[model samples]
Target: MKRSMVLVAVLVVLLGIYWLMQSNRPMTDPDRPFVQIDTAQVTSLRIESSTDTVELARRGDQWFLTKPLEFPTAARMTDQALGRLGEMRKLTLVTDRPDRFREFQVDDSTGVKVSVTDRKKTHTFYLGKTSPTAGTSYARLDGSKEVWEIAGNMTPAFKRPVRDWRDKTISEADREGFIKFTFVYPKETISATLVDSVWKVEAGAEKFDADKNQISRVTGLLSRMSGVDFADTLAADAFDAPECHLIAELALGETLDLRLIPKGEDGSQYFLRKAGAPTDYVIYKSTAEVLMRKAADLRPKPEKSAEAPPQKPRG
Candidate 1:
């Protein structure tokens, strides 16, 4: 009787060890890609969550956001997401039970649904919380029972805010390529031209040297100007009476115009509209002040005269 009991104990231990090994092994074929789709053939991408949904459609080589109101998206941002999907590899099987989906944050209420459409079919998947280990995330196919531990931190690529997906660049130009800048105010106009590589300003036939440092700051800001956020409510006709108009003349004879329209009673906000662009943007108060410079603001400040040395007390 004692020998029979020892044999049963050994059998149970062996079974437990075997179960652990099988559970740790990779479930799916490691050679297979997690998402089998050619990124080049992709036509559209969409991400839906409980709070918001963002959709992007490809037009030839360019990509634009179609849902949540049509807007241009950053090419780099979209490209990175597509690349991640194309290169995803399943590391191991996390779970296969429907009841356990919520524990992994892969349920309908918590998971972020991502759909990638190509010419022939659309591939949909749900992305859950990232794994505690770096460079891994929980993912599951739309119709599959198995949940996977996929390589790469897929949360950032698939779960981005709407503002992060949209392009915020308001103006992009070469600073050195600017030859002249004209500021038009309600009552007067000022022109600053590059004379012999030095900045000179003309206000009502009065020509004088401009502050080179100030001119540098203005051109630098305009070269890579970006808005804090979009002004979706502002209409085109809202700029009927702009507080100031800035025209940047490039060396190639192209002009980039910006109109500043004040908002609110305290004038703490302004709508910035680029000439011929479909979208309007809002800039911070500090950025608006830089573009709203007048003739006097660009002129150099008067230097203080040096005081003479005091006479000696003996004299």
Candidate 2:
């Protein structure tokens, strides 16, 4: 009886201590969303890594990348970042210890700091590497020591080079109903006009029917072309001695002119600049080949004459 009573007393004391400890701990809701922000209200964004920082601002409905370069932001890129933020849910608290932050890549030296601002308020957080759990990431709220396992891999959306955020479109013109097109090369010029849906071509003193397929390809590309990369070092003045020029006179009284500058020894790439534009865009040689078609290339190929039937009499 004495032994049983002693054992029961000890068990009661241990249970009491465990209950006290649990009561003293701060409560965390595992089901809570990682961030609570209205993405539609977001007016600006700042993404900072160890080596670079990118800042973007939204004016009305348009988003512009302000830092590193001043250009329009790619809508899909911005949408992805914002969409991930809105989708994140806190899975569990990884650690509350500051010393473990670096190990989880949530420290200031390693993590990507993402700040989103509305017209009045701003919320910031640090996004770390992907967590051990598939489709999850490690992140820490600004000014908090707690690191959490979030429900999405945020690295791809938030950690990108400046170029990926920029708009890659170089031209977005209407392909059909162009009044005229002039291709000016270093040694010759090829001009064409659309009359009753037929293309009439003039190469120097000669005039011929433009190959429909070939001319269509050129117009299609010129109507909607995107840059493979940006030539940040080159500007409008870099095309003073252009390798070729393409001028399009649209039916709506709009004119779009492009200057092509050759690059590299093997002619694998070319730098293209829009007339009066500040930046130069890099295009592949394949694109250049289409845009810089020679005068002879515009004419239809001569039909081959049918060979005379084999001479049976001689045989």
Candidate 3:
């Protein structure tokens, strides 16, 4: 072969090898694993910081907070964390020096450790400070020295306190096919019944129009009623002599009974209790008013005619 041709061939081979090395580099690999454990198979998880530790376990499909407090953890948040962990990809390697772990916030004394266990396998990693852009976070596998920036800021999910992790739902019930609804006020009691999916006043002081819109508004409110937080510390008897009561008896063999006790002389808030509920919950004054409406309040107001003002007859 010619000397110039041989030199050109050697240069081409060198460039090809360099490209291959760059392609296989960790930062460039697209399929890098962040947590290494399959989210669907994760049976339990533990998150530990210098001062606190949060433990969780999965039963069937629900995630429960077992440590720091034993309660059902919000499944939505837990699932979101698992999803982010599985989806995170390597961005860049930050450090490998043991002495620099403190600076990166991955040291045992400062860093937060998250571990997930499957049936027999387990995966654990430590998370550090997020990048300036807040788009990626620094992470390192347990027992490994290398620290790499991983996609997503992972702190939001695992660093939350027990209250933030718990399920805040107060109740879950369908409003359709409600057979009976009763409003018991201090002065009077109003009862309504549904026959063949139609609602009418069963008993009251006087006759009523059985306004559908008012009924619907109340139904919608009840359907979406959820507690802002749990007040399990409050005693159930505190609501025994409620100022008002709203009872919804459904055709589905379900009954929802809510009693509202005025919180203060102003009645701007209340300690709400549901029959058979383990704890009482707090609700805003406006919310209590909506739920504890009197029969008169449910009547739709009449609309005035939009006819033009009377004009003089060609005077």
Candidate 4:
């Protein structure tokens, strides 16, 4: 009888331990205000950094550097930021009627305050304790202020997605085959055939090394193209402004004080004038064969070497 009683006690203890373990497991759909994010839904983002402010926002599936116009933003960088945000954990703690924007000072820095607005109208949270793992960090979010204290691999914090402007402008067909490129610098008129292999400048005599970096930069700019973002595209246009025109004219070896005009069958034509140049080179999209033929025609015909001298050498 005593042995049977002992067995019953052992079974009860095991059952109790199992119940406790199950209870400790994170509750997925608890009747609570806080929402959990899994860190992968984030795609594109934008980060602005300046002397007085730093702001981040995600857009599309990439990240953009909005502070300095010249700085390049990478997609991986955005992923890292989202990953960090996801690593934060939510503590069971809850606060009633969370304070909204109490102007709390961050890091004891004057004039630097973190004003978090719940744009999604979700539950407010305050940051709590943090637990970090090798590849992940678990942080607690205060249910009141919607604030979270995150601790984890912080290396991903600085990463961001690169802004692609031409995502909608250039079609797949446009990316294929050789295209016509006409650049008008101050005193030089430069034309290039963009082939699959290289940018044959001035009819293949002068080839510009289309290295990975150059191609990446060009592709990045093109990817950001969109009709709605005409201002940014137009600003980069080399023919619209006098300064750009002059830069183009002077930068390009050959220029006729003319601007470059791009004409395509798709009704994509633009007049590009050198910063100070008066003339422009009209460029139209042409097939690779046509460009090659044009270049061949322009090549100086082989000088009929003195036939007599050739005959004497043969004899």
Candidate 5:
């Protein structure tokens, strides 16, 4: 009986060792990518879909779209895209049936293809349909037959239109250090400068008091302004600049020339344009109203009469 028990113990020990070895084996497979690539070396990225193809390349410190129009692309958005792809890992092997590429939207003709090139080599993959979870996408490495669910969304990042890819920043200067402004109107031109944190009015319209509150208010407006979108097809002869044209010359050597043009006779809507822009942006009249005042509007309102003018009582 003792001999029989000893044999059973040896058999159990052998089974435990076999299980441990299988469990300790690496999860990564030679045929698959268990992790993503480093993005520091990525010099160019090309995204292709059935409808369009967009390309972004690094030039020194900035990233630019090379095709559809060579322009500066949004920096943060570009970096976020590359970072998300770098974090991709094969979540699951989704090939359960044969000829199932179309069902996953990962077929060669239907998928969104992303190609990244570094100084050394290029890596390419196809982005299929997004997963139901909304955080992941179906992907297949170039030349690989298997499809995977990677942990990122690469569709919207690379599929923007030309105007959408252009630098949409109307102003990028720090608001605190702005020191000067030059506003030009039909009747008058006002130039205001900052000295020792106090605003000094250099020139203004006739009878204009250079009201401190109003001048400061105009200066404050610059901080809140930004470009809403590109006016790609603004008509050349569509502006009427009789109201006000403002030029804010900042300490950073940046100048913005904004003009207000009411749309129609009723003046319900307005159109605005800068000096050198090929297009004009449509804005509401209220947005440009502060800059469209005559000298009377900038003066302090009249208070109650201290000593009434009593001579003209009978007339």
Candidate 6:
């Protein structure tokens, strides 16, 4: 019984020691430092890569891309970057010595740095273990020196303006004036004028039909001139096509030679002139629905002509 008691006591002591060691074991190694990021607080961000540079600004609860003044940032890209940054905050620092954290590199360089600034303070992060998948590389944030890894790929979240050019607004005063329509080709020139309810074409020789429905559409389009959306902006290659060039040349004037001059008391005078045209038509901008309308409106109204009196026949 004495021998058994001694063995039991030894076992109990050993178990206590084992329990103490297990309890005291560090979650992370002291030589390595782990970092966590709080992405929610990040208000604005700027990223520079070999191919492009992007700036992202936060407005209210939305994010916007400020550069290029055109393309808006994608929502998924913004959410992912923010989520990753937030996840960084959960990391625990395992190192007291900064030199031990030097093994990790961000952006494939010896030192990659990321500097995050909020309303109150700025925090810097470095890069550590990197797991690259597909075209993107993911790495641990070491210190500011290693941020370059993710910096190039980081995109800012931004609210972009709608690109519907058809819904733009135009001022009433703008419509009050006449808009001169002048069509000029290499060998031919055509001119038209728009007035309140009348459309004069062919230098006042012909009239155009101006009805209520036609005037509304033209006026509405002119008023809402918010401009074209970036995505709608014509691509260089598309414009470079021979057919496109021909279309543009035929549409817009080669020079400002073909002019639409708007004038009159209420700015209602529209004068259309081609480069060498002898005469111009003055009309209201709102009068013409299309070229055909101008032609119809220009038709001369019947005039009462003076006639010899009947008394002359009796005499």
Question: Highest lDDT among the candidates is held by which one?
Answer: 1
**Off by more than 4 A, model 3:** 1-29, 264-268, 309-315
Provide TM-scores for the models: 0.80, 0.83, 0.82, 0.32, 0.69, 0.31
Off by over 4 Å in 1: 1-32, 133-135, 265-268, 302-315
Clashes of each: 0, 0, 0, 58, 0, 48
Model 3: which residue pairs collide? none
Model 1: number of backbone collisions = 0
lDDT-based ranking: 1, 2, 3, 5, 6, 4
Kindly list the per-residue Cα lDDT of model 1 for residues 1-315, writing each as its tens digit. Answer: 999999999999999999987665444454778888989999999999878899999998888999887888988899899888876888888889999898777778989999999999999989888887555788899999989998777867878889878888988889999999999998999999998899889999888999988898889999999888888778658987899899999999889999998767787778899998768888887899998778778889988999999988994
- lDDT at position 160, candidate 6: 21
Residue-level error in angstroms, candidate 2, position 119 = 2.9
lDDT of 3 by residue, 30-140 (tens): 577765667888899899888779999999988998997788887788988788767768777788999988887887887889888988788888888888767677888
**What lDDT does the true structure give each of the candidates?**
0.87, 0.86, 0.78, 0.35, 0.69, 0.41
TM-score of model 4 relative to the true fold? Answer: 0.32
Stretches of model 4 off by over 4 angstroms after superposition = 1-35, 38-74, 90-120, 123-151, 154-178, 194-315
Model 6 accuracy (lDDT, Cα):
0.41
Query: Please, what are the lDDT tens digits per residue for candidate 2 over residues 1-315?
Result: 999999999999999999987664434354588888888899999999997899999988899999988999888999998898788778778999999999988878999999999867899999999865446789999999999988768878988889899998888878885778899888888898998888999888999879988888888997889888888886547888799989989999988898998788888999998876657798999998998877678889888999988866763
Best by TM-score: 2
For residues 187-229, could you state the per-residue lDDT of candidate 4 as single tens digits? 4444545566565547334544333333333333322322221
- Ranking 1 against 5 by lDDT, winner: 1
Off by over 4 Å in 2: 1-31, 302-315
lDDT of 6 at 314: 60
Q: TM-score winner between 2 and 5, please give it.
A: 2
True-structure RMSD, every candidate: 11.1, 13.6, 10.7, 17.0, 14.2, 22.8
